[model samples]
Target chain A: MKIVLCVKQVPDTSDIKWTENNTIQREGLESIINPYDVYAFESALRLKNKYKNVNISALTMGPKQAEGMLRKLIAIGVDDAVLLSDKKFAGADTFATAKTIAAAIKSKLSDFDLIVCGQFAIDGDTAQTGPSIANFLDIPQVTYVKEVVGYEDGYLTVIRELDSGFEKVRVKLPALICVLQGEFEPVRARINGIIHSQQVEIPVYGIDDIGLSVEDAGLKGSPTYVNKAYRAPQKETECVFVESCEELAECIKKCGGICE
Target chain B: MSKGILVYSEITSDDYLHTVVFELANKAVELSKKMEDAPVMALVLTKPDLINEYKEAFQKSGFDKVFYVVDERFGTYRTDLFAKAAVQAVKQIDPEIMLVGATCQGRDLAPRISTALGTGLTADCTGLDILENGKFAATRPTFGGQLMATILCKKYPQMASVRPKVFKPSEVDVTRDTVFIKMSVDLDDYVPQIEVLEFTKKLVCDLNDLDSAKIIVAGGKGMKNAEGFALLKKLADKLGGCVGASRVAVEMGLAPQAVQIGQTGKTVSPKLYIACGISGALQHTIGMNSAEKIIAINTDKNAPIFDICDYGIVGDAFEIIPKLLEL
Candidate 1:
């Protein structure tokens, strides 16, 4: 089995702080592999462990600093790693990003059977890249996948999450699955694995390396524009405190919040 | 005549239009009014059995026209087929703005259609405004609710999706003259890459009905584990409400996305909201700020949840929830 997992490096939004003027202070914020992408990598690693002769490679497209993330993936047992780093790839939307990623996958790992990605990145939070990659590759894709249940004979069965409930479906080989952060727990790097990854040389691919022209790679390729970004307006509500749970119940009853 | 605003009236599995479509239609009507009363249209793709019902829905919902595709194959919501039909309709009609509900199916279908049409889609928009220049300015919380980005698509037929219950459904105007146009699209070229074999609809209302809950008892990262959620559920049961969760709880698997109340999840405005073990980050608060009254129960008095709640109780949720249950 041959697999490719798409990973992204994003600012850890949890520790984020807003400036006095209501703008995010980008300085000093740590960049980590997208939390959801960690699950995608973990899923691929689990599949590799389950099957024989599985070759898994993790890839990311970002600044040169993204090599750190790929290195971490290598430490956790991804067979190989590739970094799509170039100035031309900056400010790409999901559409352009998926195009560049599809080109890389086709040119580098043509015989790949499956591609896995996080359902959405915490930074952009657009769940479109993976499916858009499938569209560009002209392959099938299933998004919001909670679990990858079974794989056999070039077909994979997955449990997909729906607003109403869950759907069990089977997709053929040469497909892409976008994983949601569900029960799949991501693993840490072992000391031996860390030592081994340090010795591996990671490959970097540029815009030309992926067979894409500058016009098709970055901001020019993007169709959307962020006109403005600002802090959300806070609603004014004067809050009071209740000392005990009994007082809380009394307050709830008073607000007509408890329906008969 | 200029192209009008289009709303996709999504049909559910049980042969009824989803309420979010009506909500979108309401906004569409309001938006179209600003654009010189340029018509508000709807696109419905379904079987012939319920075509008239859907047409009636569009008419009642105040659409000026209903562009529909009727085929037996359209009974189930298939992304490949639906997006094809939708993109074809958009090409033919060429609407100025397109709105789709940010439901599970819509989230999947919209991106495919938008990508095919080379348009940008703003997902889970909490606010949509018609700029003075007439472009649609869509506002959505981004980066785990750290900032709200107001976006505009540089391309035509500006696309955006709104979460369910973000806007109120407009009152039906049964007297309006709504034209019904039957759009034809040949589905022979479409091969479904993914097939829905079976769907298991979870019957537990509390599991999926957090948006409509009058009272929502929500937990956050501090809930720690499944047992912590179990305690919140017990308190929710006593209050005759539902259990809600912050994005962290959902991310931690303490609760499912269905019950998650946050920027990434459902935007809820319950009558009374109880925050149990929730630290009250902006991401979680963005979804529940509209609640009529908020109660915070956390051991840390400085937890941000206390700042926004109307009633703050400084104590462990495990300890306080049991006391509340007894009360």
Candidate 2:
């Protein structure tokens, strides 16, 4: 079984700072593989360990800097890595992003039996890219997947987390599954694995490599755009302190106006 | 000329609309009033029989028109099926704005629908308003709740998903009336390739339902370790309240994610919110800020939690919690 995992490099939200103009300041802040995508990579490695013929590949789309994220994936135990990087791909929304990924997948259609992704990228939190790519590819896609059951010849069974409960879903092979964060423990990076990853060369594909035109893969393809962003004015409220339990009780009673 | 607002009515298994749906309906009514009798549209995607169960409720909740998409395949919540039906409905109605509850289903469905319709979506919004030109202005916390950003959608029918309990539901008027419109959708048109075999509800601790609890005891990073949360649990039991944690607590593996109350966590509104050793980051305050009264018990008097707290005590929660429990 061959599996392809899509990973994204997002600014480490922990160290994120804002510009005076309200735009995210990514300069100097480190970027890491999206925390959720780590779960996807781990899940793929787990499957590889379970099946002898299993092969895993990591796929990502962003600037050339994103290739570094793929190296981390290979170090954790992926067979290969592919980066679809192009300057024209900048400012692509979830739709265009999914289209670009779909194009890459189509370019390598015969190499994989399944595609996996993090449930959502923390930066965007849209959670739409995976399903949109699935829609674009016209394949079955499941989001918020927490557990994966055994796979049959042509079908895969998995459990999805819902608002109220969990649902068991079965989809045919060559489908997409987006794993949620903390769904599985991530694999530890081994020194030998890191050494091997340093030797593994990542294949970078551009718009032409994926057989997609610039008009169809980047900002031009994105329909949504941010018009303006401004800081919201804070609402004013008065705070009262109570030093003792009796004072607290009295304050509560006064606030309620003694119940008429 | 008036505008129409579409609300994706989130439904529970017990057949009642979720709290957030009603809140959005109430907000829609407020927005509609401002827009000169703009119709508040309720979009219900459910089984045909389930439509009747919600008709009166929608009417009372101030929906001017209820669009019901009755299909057997939509009996369950599937992202693709629901989003496709909703996008089609929006296209047919051409509402000026759409609102959905920021629950798991709404978070999943709204983004997809926005993508399908090629529109912008603001998620996890805390507030909504209409601009002079009738554009939807959605406000949500950004920069991890350090700042709030109000976004405007240049596209028509601006979409937003408001957090649950962010807006209060209005009093239901049983005598209120509405126009019902039925939409026919072909289930086979967009078949869900994935089949749901069964649903298993995780047994989350019932003691963590902080929103409805009269009293809530919450801990933060200052709680030290997992054992600190155990102490919070004991205090919660004594107070007959539920236990909640900040995002830090959940990230530290001190508590389950469900019980976490913060910007990225559950938004809880309780009568009394007791902060134990909580420094009160902005992200944490967004969840419990709506509480009727807040009491902060932290050793650091400079903790941001003290700024918004109704009562602040400059003492150790570990030492004070035990004394309070004995009292």
Residues B294-325, model 2: lDDT tens digits: 87788887777877877767777777666665
Q: Which segments of candidate 1 are over 4 A away from where they belong?
A: B171-175
Off by over 4 Å in 2: A18-25, A109-111, A183-186, A213-218, A231-260, B1-3, B34-36, B154-156, B172-176, B189-192, B202-207
Query: Which residue pairs does candidate 2 place in steric collision?
Result: none
| lDDT values, one for every candidate | 0.84, 0.77
- For candidate 2, the TM-score is 0.88
Q: Share of real interface contacts recovered by each model?
A: 0.71, 0.37
- Which candidate ranks first by TM-score, i.e. highest? 1
Write down the RMSD of candidate 1 (Cα, Å). 1.9
lDDT of 2 by residue, A1-260 (tens): 98989999877665667788866676897888887788788777778887778889889998898877788777878878889899888878677888899999998655578999998675665566887787677666777777777688778898776656778988877888988655466477899779978999888888898888887767777755554555434434445655664454354344331211
True-vs-predicted CA distance for residue B97, candidate 2, Å = 2.2
Q: Tell me the tens digit of each residue's lDDT in model 1 across A120-229.
A: 78777767788788878878888888888878888888888887778888888889999987776568788877986898888999988889998888888887778999
